[model samples]
Target: MGTLEGRLKGKVALITGAARGQGAAAARRFAAEGAKVMIADVNDAEGKALAGELGDPAAYAHLDVAEEDDWAQAVDRTVAEFGTLNVLVNNAGVLHFSPLGQTTLADYERVIRINQVGAFLGMRSVVEPMSTAGGGSIVNVSSVEGLAGMPFLVAYTASKFAIRGMTKVAALELGERGIRVNSLHPGMIDTQMVSDAAGGAEVDFSRVARRLALQRVGRPEEIADVALFLASDESSYCTGGEFVADGGATATHALKL
Candidate 1:
């Protein structure tokens, strides 16, 4: 059980793509802060393992974010287990790299379905439950690409930008219901997402590090910290905003070498 003193004590959260990486990080942090978490993912083994590791108040739900039925089931299970839904983290995403000319419709739609449509479904699914709970927070994990363009990542860029746009729209529409929606734009972080897009080729972060104002790749834990603030009461006044943790990637213009 989450202690009474924890920031998220009594709150329940559903985190997508939580079997590993950033989703896993947020799950741990939220649990430590006293929130009950539903670790939703397609990877059953890892998701089950994580739920076991988190113990009481943390459970795993198999969710295919692209499927609307999966969304309904996950939300129902969350409410059934924890009693109410208060926080949602739409963190499941895939990265694909190809020139716009080389990108196939299938490839582009795949990214949009997971990153964009999934988020839309999540927001819609939670509205009624969140209203019942008096209010809630939604964190949509976008990328720096959402802020500006990047080469060979048209599909991913489009999905993230759509997430950014949808966040604001949800915020405006859901405010009366006491639900807040916000987007998180992260810079080059040390995560497996990019390498997976590169067919498992290891990324050399040194070159990218030199261009960042922080001179280092961001960590999953760091982004989790920002997410923590958004999930808790700390960001109550914030809604429909772009909360960026991109290591100053957007500070420089395209003209910069």
Candidate 2:
């Protein structure tokens, strides 16, 4: 295949949870598309290493998504390093699996803080800067659970649903300022987050894939591609939309014979 043209040229982006997994994939894609990227995460070593790999156009910022101050610093650093912030990908999140009754308040709050509150802070922090830059895109990485409830994922589902709702609200409020906000819902992605949720064991997605329309699990790169489209001007007409990259998992209503 021929090399793809730069779709994000002249853009500056900050992506949370970019040390690894889907966030890292999106960071790489953005850089490849000619965007100056800030790989923000708490994982310093990996984030810095990825920045080095991506060379001059990318840098790493230490960001603990749950902390408001960290969000401020990350956004400031991105603008300081790259001139302005044109894209913000709220991709940092946490997952906890347990029966609703068994889930502790502490665990539930932790998930909410990172997955929901974190995105909120990110959006708020970027608004002014993005508006000054003449508008930008904010991609909130939600999940399939955001659209529907799943067993043993109460906290995660709640947080994702919050992100989905927040995305719409931000889009509506920010549209006048030329900023676009959208949510991405990915399902059964092969990432470390899923492995950790599965108790550090490999996630056997074979059975789950059988129920989906595509009959396969998704890759982090696939979701990254969708994010790329949303971040680039190609999706200028899209805002407050739920862009699902789930292998068609949400296309059916669970009906058994």
Candidate 3:
């Protein structure tokens, strides 16, 4: 009968790509739950606006995920602003649709650098502060594509799969240090990243939604709930695990029409 109040009270979090979409949703939830949040993203305007809207509970930081210096600065700012860093949600990523033969090395590396390498840097950067704070959680935002292959997504698949694997490795290595690492796999969430990747082309998710068991595309706020759980102590015993939030998309078999 008790309300879920202050679930993240006294906690501090840094979320990448938080200017909008799922990351932004998580930011709002974290703030409402009594956590200090840092909205880290390359989108300066939106990031700053979100931080302002969230008031003192949030701050904006410009972070180009693939850059080491940017990672360092973002981590430092989170600690300096919030007094400690207790959680990190590596939610920054770009989706690219390209055939295997046509996928450029440049494009492949770009996806890997942001989605894959960005998570790597985030985990590495937070260990020291999080350990000093006595413990923390790392939520790497992967995709259902990480679990299985999808057409025209070789690079994105590779990056998400790497995130899934790296999460396990980090969990094993960091458990003794009081840090928990896990991967979050979301399927077909309605977000701007897809449209942006398509060069502002209008996307029709109704067709895709029809194939889902839920028969609808996901919402960013939905995934934010899962991220909130993983970030909170509610998932204390849940490290090195895959937390999937797909709409039963993965439940189908190859023979499905």
Q: Estimate each model's TM-score.
A: 0.97, 0.98, 0.98
Specify the highest-TM-score model's number.
3
Question: In model 1, which regions exceed 4 Å deviation?
Answer: 1-5
Clashing residue pairs for model 2: none
Q: Which candidate do you rate higher for TM-score, 1 or 3?
A: 3
Clash counts for the predictions, in order: 0, 0, 0
Q: What are the lDDT scores of the predictions, listed in order?
A: 0.93, 0.93, 0.95
> For residues 1-257, could you state the per-residue lDDT of candidate 2 as single tens digits?
01668989999999999999999999999999999999999999999999999999999999998888898888989999999999999999988999999999999999999999999999999999999999999999999999998899999999999999999999999999999999999998999998888789978899989988899999999989999999999999999999998888888877831
Tell me how candidate 3 scores on lDDT. 0.95
Sequence-dependent TM-score of model 1: 0.97
Task: List the candidate numbers ranked by TM-score, top first.
Answer: 3, 2, 1
Over 4 Å off, model 3: none
Clashes of 2: 0
